[model samples]
Target: MSIQRVVAVVQDGAEPFGLGAICEVWAEPYHPDDDNPVFDFTVCTEHPGVVTGRAGFDLVVEHGLEAMADADLVCISPKHDFDHHAPAVVEAVREAHERGAWIFAHCSSSFLLGQAGLLDGRRCTTHWRYAEQLQRAFPKALVDPDVLYVEDDRIVTGAGSAAGIDAALHLLRRHFGAKVAATAARRIVVPPHRDGGQAQFVRAPVREHEAETLAPLLAWISGHLDESLTVERLARRAHMSPRTFARRFRDETGTTPLQWITNQRVALAEELLENSDLGVEQIAQRAGFGNGATLRHHFTRVRGIAPLAYRRRFTCIESA
Candidate 1:
């Protein structure tokens, strides 16, 4: 179903960043000629009164939990006390889900969905810090702590602050098409999609020395993405045996050489699609994918949309 109305549920101690992330994606108005869908966005709390945020600030919310009853999308922002959400708010979420309205939970707000019993037997995720707690609290919910977001049926759960944007964009892409989502992402000056999962954000042992050694080679590879790059070629450039380079590259970059190259090539293709008038075949060759079919194979795998479709949505042009 097309999303026309979005209601974000806020409460005492709401995280400002999480709320802002949802508002930025759904509430912001862009150019009328861009064909972007305009949503009727509302912010409501369980009680229509002054609500304090975690940052020691206050907001006077005018809408109540009932505002979410007919919303096409209902969003829940993080709160300080995940365990003790208002019964009214939980009921609002459950009702929205029952009626087939899309429900989104950002960060600790997933706990509210858990309380509402909406997450039972569903795939969900939240901030890695709270992943274990959420899983322990709701054992029946399939919680994937490694992804930036998880979408099961119509319910979406974002990992943390910025992942909210990703989840919102994902929904937009599903409802309005890639072009509309890309326009929204461009207006916000954020990438339409991100590479990898939230696992990339998790803390890992530092490889400071190895990173320092590979820094120059990494930069060189980025500049020469159009060239054929293999582990053997990179190892020769780094003055190391292929076996040693392969192991060290994984330790330093947390990904294999081929995977890193593919990501960089896809990124380059995205920039070309947004800012240039190049066709898919030319862009594919320029980004080292060899051909349009090859480019489409990797681009669709990484960005969830074809290169041509992404360009159609994001390319800036003058009207006659």
Candidate 2:
């Protein structure tokens, strides 16, 4: 559904950054940029008054739970005492979801969704630190702690900090379009896009040990994404056997060399498509796809949208 009215349900111990991130995206002031949707944003609680913040300060909330009845989107901001939830707030959340409003929970706030029974049998997540607790508390919830966020049905759950921004941007892109999301990102000085499936900062120890050893090689590979970077070719340059190089590459980068190369090529093609007026074939060759068909194949598979379509959606960024 199109999001117009957005209400954030903040309780005692609300995390400042979590609520601020929501305000940064959906509660933006008008800009000269065209086509970005402006939302009617409100902050509400179980009762309207001074809501104690998790940090040291407090926020004055003017609206009560009644504000969520007509909201298109309801955000449950993370808090310190996440398990301590107000019964009225939880009921209000369930009612909002029952009425078809999009429900988004950031970090520990997902626990509230669990209390509201919105996460049972749903693929959801919370901050990594709280994922196990959330799962243990709500055995029916499918909690995936490693991902930046998860969108199951209309419920969105994001990890802590920047991942919350990533989740909000995903919603903007899903409902409004990439251009609108990109405008919000630029205003907030964050990236325009980060896939919801991206990792949430935790890495294996093996990768940590090998990442520094391969950092220089990875930088070289990024600069030469247009070249034929076969495992054998890269192994020779790294002064190791191809088999050894392949194993080390995987451990260090968490992906195959071909996958990493293709990802970089796609990123380069995206930059050219958004910033330069180069045709598909030219961009394809420059990004090492070698042909328009190959570029279109990889681009569509990776981005879930065609190259021309993405370009059309973001072309105005050049002037913006």
TM-score of each: 0.74, 0.76
Among these predicted structures, which one has the highest TM-score?
Answer: 2
Candidate 1, superposed: residue stretches over 4 Å from native: 32-36, 177-179, 196-320
Clashes of 2: 0
Error of 2 at 108 (Å): 1.2
Q: What's the true lDDT of residue 102 in model 1? A: 95
Runs off by more than 4 Å, candidate 2: 33-36, 202-320
User: C-alpha displacement of 230 in model 1, angstroms?
Assistant: 3.4
RMSD of each: 4.9, 4.7
As a TM-score, model 2 comes out at 0.76
